[model samples]
Target: MSLAARTLELLRDEGVDRVFGNPGTTELPLLRELATTTDPSYVLALQEFSAVSAADGYARGTGRPAFVSVHAVPGVSNALIGMNNARRSRTPLVITAGQQDQRFLRDAPMLGGDLVGLAAPACLTAEEVHTGADLLPLLRRAFARVRRQPSGPAFLSIPMNLLAADEDVPVPSRIPAPDAGPSPAVEEAAAVLRSAERPAILAGDRVGATRSVAELTALAEALGATVYPQPQYEYVNADSEHPLTAPSPHFTGTEIAKALAGHDVLLVAGAAIRPHVWTPERPIPDGVRVVQLDDDPAEIGRSYDVEVGLAGSVGATLAALTALLPGREADRERGARIAETLLRERTTWRDRARAGVDAGGPLDPASAAQAVADAVAPGTVVVEEAPTTGPALRRALVQRDAGDYHNSSGNGGLGWGAGAAVGLALAHPDRPVVGFLGDGSAMFGVQGLWTAARLGAPVTYVVVDNGGYRAVSDALPPGFEGTRLGGVDWAGLARSLGLHGTAVEHGSEIGPTLAAAQRSGEPSLVVVRIRGGAS
Candidate 1:
């Protein structure tokens, strides 16, 4: 078999059913093989950014490493932003870019830049394939590394000459995942939680990535502890509707300190407390005993000192802790009180959102988000990118499943949500997929709409057209120049890209329009106009 054929077979063996990419000259060989094969299909994107972001979403959806093949140097460069997002979220992905033939190295070919060096910053490992013999080994290593606990993106640069070569490489075995057993330190960690008057659990992206939210919920219930998902979490780490799942405070050291103030013991599971902005006060307050559980040991005690570090898989460790610390009457009573407080706070938020709807000029961010929450059906998958409206959206939308919600890695990258929405729709065809995007963020990856149209992916994009980059503009000093944006018709843009499109100028129209768009079962966009600046 040709090297390209063998590579496809290996990917199939490793559970990658589709390859997302925008092909070029160097990628033709693999593209040809993909054309001939039926098992592992190719999903083309208009740009490398869309391709990588699509793969990132697919990986998060399937709980497996996704495969992507892009053009050599420029393609790798185009893909870097999405790769950075993937790396930050620790999403498992195997990204390959085709390089120029080996014989042209001395000639300084157009696309002959060093792929490994360019991709290294965003990948766990990046290597160039020298010959056909080196192909399978490198591919195997990439798959293995990405599937291991604390999984992440890996990059491989394969030359066109090697891919076209008819060298008979050995059939590769399925890659093995590293053991995800709980650590022996779970006993000590449980002891700390059990002794504390108030225990708190912090869930992070890995909890959702590993499909361990159930275990997280179970452990929280067992200890009767309040659960808070990490700030800027890439996935739904806990069910939003769960009583123990409290809203995360504002992203600042002072707010985090205030929220976590009463907890005597904090279980840092698959998350490190991260604040969006720095402040003088520590995020984790003093005298709070910390018990950290993580598959990646490097994360344990990385920020604050920990009383016990449980290095293991999040699900296994949480399950072990739950087994060790059974529920008690006092714990149950405390949990009930916490649940009551959370319920009251949520009711107030809903009331505020309703008020926005009633007394509206342009829609408030909270009211617009509430409309989306009301429109989406149960089991719908929501992808978040509206930085201005996101907090309101989170509070309003209900996520009952681990994979029901996803968002950008919060690594300062903007174009991910548009393409990710397409990929997510493709991944979960049975479930509705909705993308809540800022008008500014949508423009960054707006080309993704064409791919969604071409593939017939059922996705509803809710663009909160607030006219500008409100999230950034809100932070800037008054009278700052060059940030304001307006005048583009988002619905017209979506229609031009071959999807059904509509605009909602009034607050009351938001929910009905979104509901209609989602029910269409075709890629569509609803541009909901709202007041601009500072949300």
Candidate 2:
């Protein structure tokens, strides 16, 4: 079998059910091989950025490493931002980019340049394959490194000629298997929790995605422990309204550390607890016991030396702890009271945000976001890349119980959002999928609108058009000048992409516009035009 076939075989062996990518001439050989194989699904994205994000989201949702294929130079460069986002979010992805044959690489053959250079600054680690035989080992190393440590994206490039070439190269030998599960340290963490006077559980992405909220909730309730959802990466628990929740302190940095330190013990579940999330000015109070449990080891003890570090499946660890922790009525009563308070707080906040928000003019970005969120049934899927307005949008679209809320992650790779919406829409057609994008983000993958339109996807897009790359410009740090990205015409672009499109400048036009798009039967776009700087 050709190296392309063997490489594909390897991916299949890795249990990759699908690959999300955009191809180029250099990747023709692999694409042909893909056509011959039916085990791994191939998802065509409009751009490399979208392809990478699709892979990222796929990994995040399915809890397995996903593959991404893209061309060298131009394509890889376009995909860099999304890769960066994946790295930031620590989403596992194995990315393959096409490279010109090594013979002409130094001479700058067409579409040939420094791929490693372009990718290294953006991805976790990137390398090139020198020979067909080099692939098996490199693939093994790359995949393992990305999965084992930090768990982000790793890149492996193949020369176009070699991928299509025949050689004395035998199919490469298989490598070591990947290991994932909770560890022996669970007993130690439970011991700490059991002995503590006041304990808290910090929930991160793993806890949320692994469906470990029940265990976490149980542990918290059994000990009267406070449960705080770490706002970044992953979120746990159904909602702040759910019973058996103890609201964590709103303060981060020094205050968070102080609060955590003051406690007799703190159990960090699914949280990286990296320096960025904690305070350095004041250490966690003296004598505080900090225990950590996570699926990935790299995140365990990243900030402070962990008293107990357990590496295992989040679900397994939570199950063990829940089984061991006997219920205490005093703790249970405290937890119920906290849950009630949080529910009240959440209700008050939602009511204020939802009040007449439907009647706001020119469609206030926050108000519009709230309206769309309210209209959707729970359990509806959302694909949103509405940058600049993300913080406000997140608040207004408070994800309550039911459905999944997906964004571009922390990567902020603009173009990936629309295409990811497409993948998610295809992944779960039974649930309605809605994508919200700022004009700038929409520009990145609007090509996807046409693809979705053609597929007859039930995907609806809410375009917040303010005429510019609002986030990019404002995100520039102090003293940075000449911040201008010109502008993008979102409505025109959407229509051009073969999706039924409309621009609504007035608030009165929003509900009807969204309602029509949602029921359009085919993929459609609704662009809400706003005055500049509305992000």
Candidate 3:
């Protein structure tokens, strides 16, 4: 078998079923080989960045590494944006590129500059295989590294000579190694949790993945505690309005201190206790008991100190806690109070966010979000990265089912939105995937829009443009009066990338625009210009 063909088979044996990519001349050899391989299917994208980003999303959703094939130097450069996104998000992805023939070592071939250099700073590991014999080991190491705790993207460069060479290398069937870890600390933490009067638990992306909610709910109820899901962790399916969910009154130093100070014991399950969270405006209470749980050792108490730190599978930890605590009457009573409070607060917050929107200016971001909400059928997936307007978007969205929310939780990167939308659409093509990205973030890895257009994907891009980097506006930079840094011709930008784009300037225009896109069943976009400034 050809080296390239056998390598693709090895990847497929590793449970990587898809390669999302964009082809270039340097990558042509691997592309042709990938095309012939039966195990892993190849999906084409219009840009290298989108290809990498899509692979990131596919990996995040499926809990398996995805492959991306790009050209040697230029393709690696373009894919760097996504490589960074995947690294930040801790998504397991293996990006492969075709290098110039090995014979061009002394003299620089057109696309043969240092490939490892381009992918190094952006990904977890970047390696260039010198011979066909090195492919299996390098590939194995890349897979192992990317799947390790604090998992991330990795890269490898395949020279043309190796791709075409006849090498007798042992290609073993890939069996994914188990990543299970000890959870003894979880039991000890539960012991601490049982006796506390006022306890709180925070859920993150990991919790949303497995048994986070049920276990946390049990523990919170038992302790008569409050629960908080960090938006930074991508909504833990714990709504801001849920009684079980605590208020993040402010992210500022003063505000966070006031918010977290009341709890006597705080358990961070699958969520990070960022320094800003515990000691925001004020130093956290000196003796508050803190327990941190995560599968990755590197992430344990990173931003905040933990009295007890547990490293193991998140679900395993939660399950162990459930067994130890069993159940408690005080927990149930406190849980009831939390539910009642959550209902009241959720309604109030939703009303407050919606109040100004259904009334003011040329268009309201809330009502505009609401329009998209109405236009979307249930079961559709939403990949949200609209940080500033996150509260409004969450309030607007009606779907609360598990996995309906696509999280870029660990890394709040901008380029993740557009390309991630492409990946979700590819993974679940039957469902309509909407990307709620702000304009500033849109520019980060927007080449995905071109990919969507080329695929005629059923995903829609609903850009909330308040002009400039709205996230950077803490209330005007130095000179500007309002929030806008500048104007972005959203529709013009989309059209330039080959997507069917439209401009929606008023609240009334949202419904029609969304309806048309849904009806067309094409990759379309609606750029809604709304007044900037926090709601």
Candidate 4:
């Protein structure tokens, strides 16, 4: 078999049913093989950003490595933003790009700039096969490495000429991921938690990535710990509406410090304390003892000093800790107190959200988010990229399922939500998907709507049209120019892309439009103007 044919066969063996990419001249060899294949279909994106982000979302939804094959140099560069986001979130993706023909290397051909060097910054591993016989082994290695602890994007640059070469080669046996058994420090971590007078847990995206939220919740309940999802987390760390849950102070070190103020023991579970802003206040409060648990050993004590570091599978370690610690029955009084505090905070936030919805005027971000939250279905998957609306949306929505929620990664890349929503819908056809995007962010990924329309993915895109890059403008000096955006017809753009599009004129229209679009089980877009910019 030709190398291209063998590559597809290997992908099929790995259970990758969809390959996402944007085509280029160098990629034609592999595309020819994909064109005739019935098992692993080619998912085309208008841009490389959408291609990579969509694959990232698919991997997150399916809990396996998703595939992407971009063109050589420019395509790889175009996909880097999404790649960085995937790397930060630890989404397993085996990304490949067709390099220019190896024969012209000394001549410095156009579109032949260093593919491996360009992609290495965003990939866990980036290498190029020197010969057709080496492609299979390189791919096998990438697949295995990308699924290891702290799983992330792995890249390979395959020469177009090599892919078309006819060579008989032995496919290497698949390397199975090693089981991360109980951590040696689980007992020590549990001892720290059990002895604490007041404790708080910092949960990360990996909690949901590993499908360990239940274990995390149980551990939280056992210790009566207030669980705070890490800032800019990519997945559901804990249920938003759970009584033990506390709001994340995303991007702000001072706010994070405030959240950690009263806790004596801070248990960091699969989370890194990397607040975006620079503030004098330390993220972890002074004199607080820290017990950090993560499947990736590098993440433990990565940003702060830790009293105990437990490196093992997040699910297994959390389960072991829960088993070692006293049950919820022992902490009934503390649990009740924490529940009351959370309930009171929730009530205040809801009241504010309700007050922000004025029928005669544009809705506030919280109100708009509340409407989307109200409209989501029971098994809905939500992907968020709205900077202004994120905190409000998190407060408004209630997500209980392990993988129900995801967001743009800490890399702070925009344009991820639309493609991610499409990928999620494709992965879970039975579940509706809602993508909450800031108008600015939506424009960055507008091309994804076409892919969604083509695939008929059931994604309801909620564009919170705040009239500008309000997140940036709000922080900039008052007279900063070029941040304000106006007069773009978002609904019309969606309609042009062949999805159901509606412009929400009032707050009352938001929920109904979203619900109807989701019910239709087709790609759709709802644009709602909110009180931001000059609005």
lDDT of each: 0.86, 0.70, 0.73, 0.87
CA lDDT for candidate 3: 0.73
**Model 1 residue 49 lDDT?**
92
In the range 1-535, model 1's lDDT, one tens digit per residue, is 8998888888888988989999999988898998887779889899999998888888877777899999999999999999998887888899999999989877989999899999999999999999899999899999999988566789999999999999989967776776778889988888889998899998877788778999999999988899998877777889887888888666778988898998999998788566777799998999999998888988888888999999987888889889998899999999998899988888888878877875557788888888789888777999998877888888898877788899883777888998998888878889989988988888888878888999889899999887777877787875565567778888898999999999976888877888888888999999887776533
Provide the TM-score for each candidate, comma-separated: 0.97, 0.83, 0.89, 0.98
Predicted structure 2: clash tally: 10
Stretches off by above 4 angstroms in model 3 are 35-39, 179-182, 235-242, 247-255, 273-285, 364-367, 398-402, 409-412, 475-487, 492-498, 533-535
Task: For candidate 3, write residues 297-376 as lDDT tens digits.
Answer: 77886766688898888877877877778667877777787678777876776676545555545456666676676677
Q: For residues 1-535, what per-residue lDDT tens digits would candidate 2 score against the true structure? A: 7778777777877768787888798898889998987678688777788787767766765667788999988889888888888887677888989898878777888999878888887777899888777877787677767666467889988898878876555544545645666577777777877887767777766776666766676667777777766643333343544554434433346655654664778788886543333345644556778888887777777767679988888878877876777877776776666667766765675576566454534555666666666655445677777755554455545454223767653444567677777766766767777887777777767667766776677788888766565545555663343533345566676678778778776665677777777766568788776544523
Over 4 Å off, model 2: 34-42, 121-125, 140-149, 168-179, 195-198, 234-240, 244-264, 273-289, 363-366, 392-403, 412-414, 444-451, 465-489, 504-516, 528-535
Judged by TM-score relative to the true structure, which candidate is superior, 1 or 2? 1
lDDT score, candidate 4: 0.87
lDDT of 4 by residue, 1-535 (tens): 8889888889988889999999999988899898887679999999999999899889988888999989988899899999998888888999999989999988998888799999999989999989877899989989999879888899999989999988897677888878888689887888888888888999987788888999999988888888998887778889888899988876678989998898999988888677777899989989999999888999888888899999888899899999998766657678889999998998899888876665577787888888888789888999999887888888888878777888974678889989988888888888889999989989898899999999999899998887888877887776566787788999899999999989989888877788889889988999998887632
Candidate 1: residue 57 lDDT (0-100)? 81
> Which residue pairs does candidate 4 place in steric collision?
none
Pairs clashing within candidate 2: 85-411, 181-312, 181-313, 182-312, 182-313, 205-234, 253-279, 261-285, 379-402, 379-403
Backbone N/Cα/C clashes per model? 0, 10, 7, 0
